[model samples]
Target: MASTSSYSSSPCAACKFLRRKCMPDCIFAPYFPPEEPQKFANVHKIFGASNVSKLLNEVPPHQREDAVNSLAYEAEARIKDPVYGCVGAISVLQRQVMRLQKELDATNADLFRYTCNEMPTTQPAGAGIRRINEAAAGASSYPQSSVYYYNPSPWNNDLCGDGYQRGGDNNM
Candidate 1:
């Protein structure tokens, strides 16, 4: 007796799941190789086989690989964290970013304070007296108009004009 049986190589994950022969030109062959059945299994379990098929069919060939990878990652995340999934991961990352930003702001403020404290307070000869005299003369001449006096300080600039003050009794 002679047997006329034929054997073919294993089908891709999709065809294996569907219990059909995998064609050479099947769309799922490239992404879902027969060796990695778990990848397709996860995707199929999360998103149904029919939905996966429809998605693969709708997307262009060039984009199908990325779509498959994205689907697989999302599926795995959903499996691990059923309640929040990727959103939970995103929330954690956002919190980390906010914390880092606050730390950075504090560091910058500290550096500014240190640098301001380290700066010299002494002015050139006659600079301070001349500025005081000029301010007095300007204040006397412009009694009705607001007069501004200049002072060299890192924290506060002596801006006294329009009823506003920097280091005076005015509201500003």
Candidate 2:
């Protein structure tokens, strides 16, 4: 048997798939190593080998790696989920982010409610009522009142008890 040192290194996946010699300056040599045949296979299946080669030729060498990664990710996503693929995954992640944000907002609102309830009413009850009215009037003057105005008077039973009377109206 020939010595191991005498045996030449294997060609890259691209070169091997194309049944051609892997040149030192081959574009696919770095990205499509001989060890990972699946990378090249995925790329080839999604975007034909000729198209990939052309794309590599058109773009600068530095950008090729990122392009290859994007291509591979898209190919894998497509193979796994042919119907919606990467777009579906992205949409699902966006929805999750939105849900988490809403939960965070609710938690913050609860914290604010708890903190406000804990603070001692230094001023007379009438003065607090006056301040609330003033804040409401000020908020109404602005077009975007929702951002500035938060009804501290608890509307739900979970947050605050119906201990404080509001202008003789115990409904709230």
Candidate 3:
């Protein structure tokens, strides 16, 4: 909001553009100071002075500043893109957010894979042996090496030389 005291000597942007005397109680004076002539020009060009005054008068004083700023921003956006304006900017931002979200999900999946790979293979008695389910861990996110076919029985020496258990259940 512009200071009315500062605009006392010179006419406000609205008054200056309209070529009218800027009264002390001018409604546009507080929002449109003499320093920013283009601000009022764009707003007035988009929404007429009469309509703006009526709107400002009808709106609550506490909300007048927000209304004025919104009008200015919308007016500038409309000038830039007459078809979509602020909606175009919002659409572009929304698309960027969606793209970033997908990228984040892929990165998280890779991190989960790396963390699981680096984990210690040994587990406590109650915890049981870690085994990958073909239905669950066979997704592309989990590499083929993650699939386990081990029988963690102490008496069973059926494991291969490289410590990889095999033979019984095979899901190709």
Candidate 4:
């Protein structure tokens, strides 16, 4: 149950945006609070006041909050991109996941090769750590040598090795 304080203070987002009095039994009061006016604005703009009210009423009481949240998210996404909307965002995220998976596969392959003694990782002891420290201390490009530089930072790995950050570029 929504408290009387919510009712007594400024109106709920729906009522405030709709320019109406918020009674105790207002349908949108619980889910759309007075503070988050944008949530109700986007929702009402996308799905209309009567439609959102009907949806909330049709949904089970226990699930109304989740329904409202989903509506708000979709509304916001739709406002950001009218043509593709949520699908565009989902596609971008899917591509990011696929790329990460491929990187993971490449890393695993490197690990397997190292474990099987297939490649010559024959650098002096503590050289990788020293290179990491130098890179951390603001060295852009290390000397071209057999020493494999190991940068702990994944994004800024300019190391000349089979590391995944060699030539590929990404928006993220």
Candidate 3, residue 85: lDDT = 82
lDDT string, candidate 1, 1-172, tens digits: 1111221577887778778888876767778877778888889889988899899999997899899999888888889888887888889999998887656555544443443343345634433312222233223232334433333333333322122334433333
lDDT of each: 0.63, 0.65, 0.72, 0.71
What's the TM for model 4? 0.62
User: Residue 172: error of model 2 in Å?
Assistant: 31
TM-score of each: 0.60, 0.62, 0.67, 0.62
Residue-level error in angstroms, candidate 2, position 70: 1.6
Evaluated with TM-score, which candidate comes out highest?
A: 3
Sort by lDDT, best first.
3, 4, 2, 1
Evaluated at residue 56, the lDDT of candidate 2 is 87
How high is the lDDT of residue 108 in model 3? 42
Clashing pairs in 3: none
Residue 90 C-alpha lDDT in model 2: 98
Pick by lDDT: 1 or 3, better one = 3
Query: Least lDDT summed over 10 consecutive residues: which range in candidate 1?
Result: 129-138
Candidate 4 residue pairs in clash (backbone atoms < 3 Å): none
Q: Write the per-residue lDDT of candidate 4 for residues 86-106, one digit (tens) a residue.
A: 989999999998898667666
Candidate 1 vs 2: which has more lDDT: 2
Candidate 2 residue pairs in clash (backbone atoms < 3 Å): none
Per-residue lDDT over 52-106 for candidate 2, one digit per residue giving the tens place of the 0 to 100 score: 9999899897798888888889988888888887998999999998887656556
